[model samples]
Structures are given as structure tokens and as C-alpha cells.
Target chain A: EPEVTQTPSHQVTQMGQEVILRCVPISNHLYFYWYRQILGQKVEFLVSFYNNEISEKSEIFDDQFSVERPDGSNFTLKIRSTKLEDSAMYFCASSDQYNQPQHFGDGTRLSIL
Target chain B: EDKVVQSPLSLVVHEGDTVTLNCSYEVTNFRSLLWYKQEKKAPTFLFMLTSSGIEKKSGRLSSILDKKELFSILNITATQTGDSAVYLCAVYISSGSARQLTFGSGTQLTVLP
Candidate 1:
């Protein structure tokens, strides 16, 4: 079974530094999404992308956060300035169509120092 | 705000025992519900439920949605140690041209050998 893959399983960065999390969604999947899970909190949606543009984003996806599909296979989430609160497991997910089940990647654990 | 709530945050059972996890939600323009199993890194897809009454099953795990009552249940029978994991429930809601998932806190299941 084809699956979504994320790079840098664990990332550690300084508080004021920039960080970029990368994901390669299933080859044929169209819709892509980004979510985060704080250590003991529920997984929270960050943004959704389709047709090469951001379809929707949560309040947590503020000025510091941005997503880009730089190429056909890579989806990247960039945080301009990291903070302690930004430390979490960032997950990438994709679905083939609308209302379909979105498959998740193993996740990138971001740790801010 | 759209919310998904799961009951029994934690559970422990011996092998061969049966267990059921509950999820309830309150949201507008409900699209679908999904169940996932999280062991350590990622959440693996389990099932997706859209209509009520009809059950989606795989092996010893089964799930059903109750659209009218706004709840869903996942059942695992004759469980094994491998079945131990955090079960997450999420609801999809239509948001303009996009949709996002709202996840529950998840139920942690521990199956003892």
C-alpha cells in the first residue's frame, strides 16, 4: 500500500530560528493537509491544500506559518519564527478525493529549544 | 466550534477480551467520521463511516456511525496485545470550498498478554 512519507522524523531548532517540515504525499492523492498534536492534547488541524492553493487554515496557522507545494511531490510547511509552544508532532496527510479518508504520515516531532 | 469527544480515556484488558470505544460529535455540515489507531509515531487509518446503521469492518475491528445521534463506536473483539494503542476519532465538516477534521482526545487501550 502506498503511504505518505515525512522527512526528518525529529527536528530540533532554536526558538527564533526558522523550520521547515517536509512531506511527500501519496503520488496519486490530490488533497493535502497539515496537523499538529501537542504532547497531551488532541490533534489540531493547521491547513489544507488543493489545486495548488491553500483551501483553508485554522487559527493556529497564523502569520508565522505557511505551506507550499514547491514541486509535484513535495509539500512543505515553514514556520518563520519558532516558539516553545510550536513544539509538537507535525503530521502530513492526504486524501484522493473529497470526503474520503485522509491517510497520515509517521509525523515530524518538532522540538524548540 | 466543532468538537469530537471520546469516552474512557484509558482501558486495560487481557487477551481475548472484547472492548468498545465511543465517540460523539457536534458539528455543522457533517461530512464523515474516521477512526485511527496510534501506537507511537503515526495514526494508521482504520475505518471511515459516513452513513448511519451500516458497519465497516476489517478483521476483528468494526465501526458504525449514527448520524442522527451524532456518535460512533469502534469495537475490537478477541483482542490481542497488538491491539493496544490510542484510538482516535475525528469528524469532517465542510468549510467553504474546503473541509477540516476535528479530532477527539483519543482513548488509550492497553491489551495485556
Candidate 2:
């Protein structure tokens, strides 16, 4: 069903280290998004990208967070400095248009030590 | 800030029983409401409701939205063990040309055989 795919299902890194989470959205999708879910918490939006630029971001997506579509098929989220609070399941989603339903990936479990 | 609230943090039901999940939201410029089922990982899209009084059905699952009431409900009839999963409700809000989703804490459903 042409689903979004994320790499490194599990990631463990030191508190001060940098981490990059990778996603390959549906080939024909247009809008991309990043969301994270802290254990037992509601999923929170991080950022949304379209037309090769960030269209929206939440407060949680602060200076340490950045997203880029380095190539046509890949979307990446990088955290400059990891923190204990940053540990969560990061999910990637994509939609064909603004009004379409977004499809989510299995998610990357990021654990900061 | 937009908020989504889901009721009955968890539920346990026997096979063949019927279950209904609830979701309500408060947001400006409401765009749509979506329901997803999360098993071990990714959230699989179940239904997307935009207009009121319209019921979307798939197999034994059905969902409806009440835009006027700012709520939605998902019903699973004759449930099975496979229906055990966390049901997430999310609302899309439009901001200028951008939009993002705000998710509820999700209802955990466990179907016993």
C-alpha cells in the first residue's frame, strides 16, 4: 500500500551527541511531517514540510531540531544535542495534499543515555 | 492551543462484544478528524472525517464525525483479538496555508479471546 518507512527502528545515543532519524515517505506523497510520542503521552507534532521548506513547527521543535529533504525521496530529522527528554518514538508521516489523510511510518525509537 | 481528548484510557472486552471509542476536540479553523490503530508500531489510518453526519464504514468498523459538537466516535462491532490496539484520535487545524495534527492520548483496547 505504498507506506512510509523509517530506518534504525531503535537508536541509542549519549546525552550530548547528535542523532539523525531517517524516513522515506511514500513515493508520490507531497507533504511530510515529523511527530514524537513520549512514553504514555499523546503524539506531538514537531514539524511539517512542503515545497522543500518548513511550513510549520511546534515549540518542541526548537533550536536543537531541524528537518531536511536532502534528496527527492528522503526526509531526515536531526537533533543537534540530545537530551533525556528527547527520548521517544519518532514517527514520520506523509500526505498527498494538505487535505488528505496522512500516513505514518512504524517509528524510530530514540533512547538517550 | 488545540487540544484533543479521548475517553476511557483503557478497555478490556471479550470477543464478540461491541466497543465504541470516543474523541472530542477544541480547535480553531478545524480541518478534519482522523482515527488510527496502533498495534506494535505504526499507526494505521482507519478513517478520516471532514463533514458532519457522515458515517464511514469498513468491514465491522465504522466512524462518524459531529462537526457541530466537535466530537467523533469509532465503533467496532463483534470485536476480535486482532482489534486489540491503541486507538488514536487526531484533529487537523489549518493555519494560513499550513496545517498540523494534534493527537489525543489514545485509548488502549484489549480484546480477550
Candidate 3:
């Protein structure tokens, strides 16, 4: 089965540094999303992208967060001035159309110290 | 805010046993409900339930959605050690031509031999 894939399985960063998490969604997918799971917490939706624009975002996706689809397949999330609370597993997901089951990537573990 | 609630945050079952995981949601204009299995890194897609009373099944796993009651259940029969993982339930809701997901805290299932 074709699956979503994320780069740099793990990332270690210091507070106030910048980080970029990359994902290559399934080739034919049209909608992309980013979610985060804090240790011992529920997975929370961060943002969803479609047609090169952010369609929806949560409070956690504040000023410091940005997402880009630089190319056909590459979707990335950048975090500027990371805080200690930013440490969590960031997941990328994609779906072919609306109301479809989304496919998820093996998450990128972001660790901020 | 859309909310998803999963009951019995953890479960333990012996090999060949059966288990059921529950999920309930409160949202507007529900689109679909999904079940995923998370081992350590990624949450693999399991099933998607859209219409109520219609069951979706794969091998030993089955899921059904109850729109009238705003709930769903995932059943695993003859569980194996490999089934030890966190089972996540998520709901997709449509909002003025946009849709987003809300996830519940997963149920950690440990199927021992």
C-alpha cells in the first residue's frame, strides 16, 4: 500500500531555535494535514492544507507555525522560536478527497530542550 | 469544539481473546469516523465508518458506527500479541466546505501470550 512518509524520524532542537519537519504525501493526494501528539496526551489537529492554502488550523497552530507545499509531493511544517512545550510527535497525513480516510506517516519526533 | 471520547483508556487480553474499544463524539454534521492502530511510530489506517448500522470488517477486526447515538465501536476477535498497540478513533466533521479531524485519546491494548 502506498503510504505517507516523513523525513528525519527524530529531531533534537534547543529552545528558541527553528525546526522544519518534512513530509512526502501520496502522489495523488489532494488534502494534507499536520497533527501533534504530546507524550501521554491525545493526538491534536494542527492544520490542514489544500490548494496551496491553509483551510483550517487550531489554536496550537499559532504565529510560530507555518506549512508549505514546496513541490508536488513535498509538504513541510516549520516551527520558529520553539518552546519547551513544543516537544511532541508531529505527524503528517494526506487524503485523496474530502471525507476519505486519511493515511498517516511515521511521525517525526520533535524534542526541544 | 468538536470532541471525541474513548472509554477504558487501557485494556489487557490474553491470546485468542476478544476485545472491543468504544468511541463517542459530539460534533456538527458528521462526515465519517475512522479507526487507526498505532504501534510505536505511525498510526496505520484500520477502518472508516460513514453510515450508521453498517459494519466494516477486515480479517479479525470489525467496526460499526451509530450515527443516531453518536458513537462507534471497534471489535477485535481472537486477538494476538501483534495486536498490542494504541487504537485511535477520530471523527471528521464538515464545516462550510471544509472538513477537519478530532482525535480521541487512544486505548492502549496489550494482548499477551
Candidate 4:
């Protein structure tokens, strides 16, 4: 059972600093996504990526957020400047096709100070 | 705007008891509904349904989708302490723009001995 994997299970950064969350989706997956969950809130979609470009993004994924597939196996989400409200559990997920079910990673807990 | 809602924010049950979790969604271009189990770490995939009136089952857990009503249900029978976790229901919106998933707040299930 191959699964998505993320690095830095927990990240702590100062406000106004830049942060990058990394994920390695399933090797064969084509569609990748990023989602976040504030403590006690529902999971919210951030962005979706396919064919080496961003397919869609939410309002939360504003000017501060950017995603890139820097390599064949790594998908990275970079936040230009962090804020207290940005603290949440960031999850990476991938699916084989457009309408298929996605497999998720363990998530990286981002904490802004 | 797409939305997913799960009833009963939290539940408590004893071993051997049966429980049913409900999920409702309102989304454009609904493609599939999925269920996931989350403990302390990542969420594990459980089931996915694309058609209405068809049931998908795995072990003691089973799920059915009702496209007409725009809702789904997950049932777990003969529960054990191991079943204690947060159950999440998500809906896939399949459009050319990007594939996004809307997730509910999730139901927290606690099974006691």
C-alpha cells in the first residue's frame, strides 16, 4: 500500500517568515492537492496541481502561497510570509485520475509564533 | 460554493455496539463521495462511491451514496476501541478547472470497553 509522505511533521516559524512544506505523493499519481484544517475546523482546500501547473486555488491560497513540482517526486507549498492565522495542519493528497479518490499524507502541523 | 456537513460532532459508544455516521453535501459537478478515518496522524482512505443506490463495504464498515438526496452514510458494526477516531466525509467536485474535494467537519467516535 503505497502512501503519500510529507517531511517535517511539525514546523514552527516566526510571523513574517517564509515557510515551505514538502510532500512526496504516490509515485504514479497525477493529480496533487493541498488542504488545511484549522484546529476544530473543517478541512479546507488550498490548491490543486496537475500537468506541472496549478489547476485551481481557493481564496485562502492568496498571494502568499505558491506550489511547485520542483522534481519528479516532490511537491512543495511555499508561503512567502507567514501569519498567525496560517497555523494549521497542512495535508498533501494525490489521486490517480481526475475523479478518483485521493490518498493523503500524515500532514505537517504548521505553528506560527 | 460547495459544502459538506456531517452530523453529530462527537459520539460515544461501547464495544460491540453499532453506529452510523451521516454526511450531506451540496456541490456543483459532484463526481464521487469518499470516507476516511483519522486518528492522531494522517487520514486513511476507507471507501468511495460514484453511483447512487450502490453500497460499498469493507469488513464491518459499509457506505452507501444517495445522489438524489446528495448525502451518504457510513455504518460501523460491532465496534471496538480501535474504531475510535474521527470519521470524515468528503465530496469530489470534478470540473475542468481543477479537481477539488470539500470535506465536512467530521464525526469523532469514541468506543469504550
TM-score of each: 0.99, 0.99, 0.98, 0.98
Lowest summed lDDT window (length 10), candidate 2 chain A: A37-46
lDDT for A44 in candidate 2 is 94
TM match of model 3 to true structure: 0.98
Error of 2 at B72 (Å): 0.7
True-vs-predicted CA distance for residue B57, candidate 3, Å: 0.8
Instruction: Give the C-alpha interface root-mean-square deviation per candidate.
Output: 0.8, 0.6, 0.9, 1.2
Candidate 2 residue runs with Cα over 4 Å from true position: none
Looking at candidate 3, what is the lDDT of residue A17? 100
Q: Which portions of model 3 show Cα errors greater than 4 Å? A: none
> What C-alpha lDDT values do all the predictions have?
0.96, 0.96, 0.94, 0.94
User: At residue B98, what lDDT does model 4 achieve?
Assistant: 76
Residues A30-106, candidate 1: write the lDDT tens digits.
Answer: 99999999999999999999999999999999999999999999999999999999999999999999688899999
DockQ-superior candidate, 2 or 3 = 2
Clash-forming residue pairs, model 4: none
Interface Cα RMSD for candidate 4? 1.2
Q: How good is the docking of model 2, as DockQ? A: 0.92
Docking outcome class, model 3: high
> Taking the tens digit of each residue's C-alpha lDDT, what string does model 2 give over B1-113?
78899988999999999999999999988999999999999999999999999999999999999998899999999999999999999999988888898999999999999
- Per residue, candidate 3 scores C-alpha lDDT tens digits across A25-88 of 9999999999999999999999999999999898999999999999888999999899999999
- Clash pairs, model 2 backbone: none
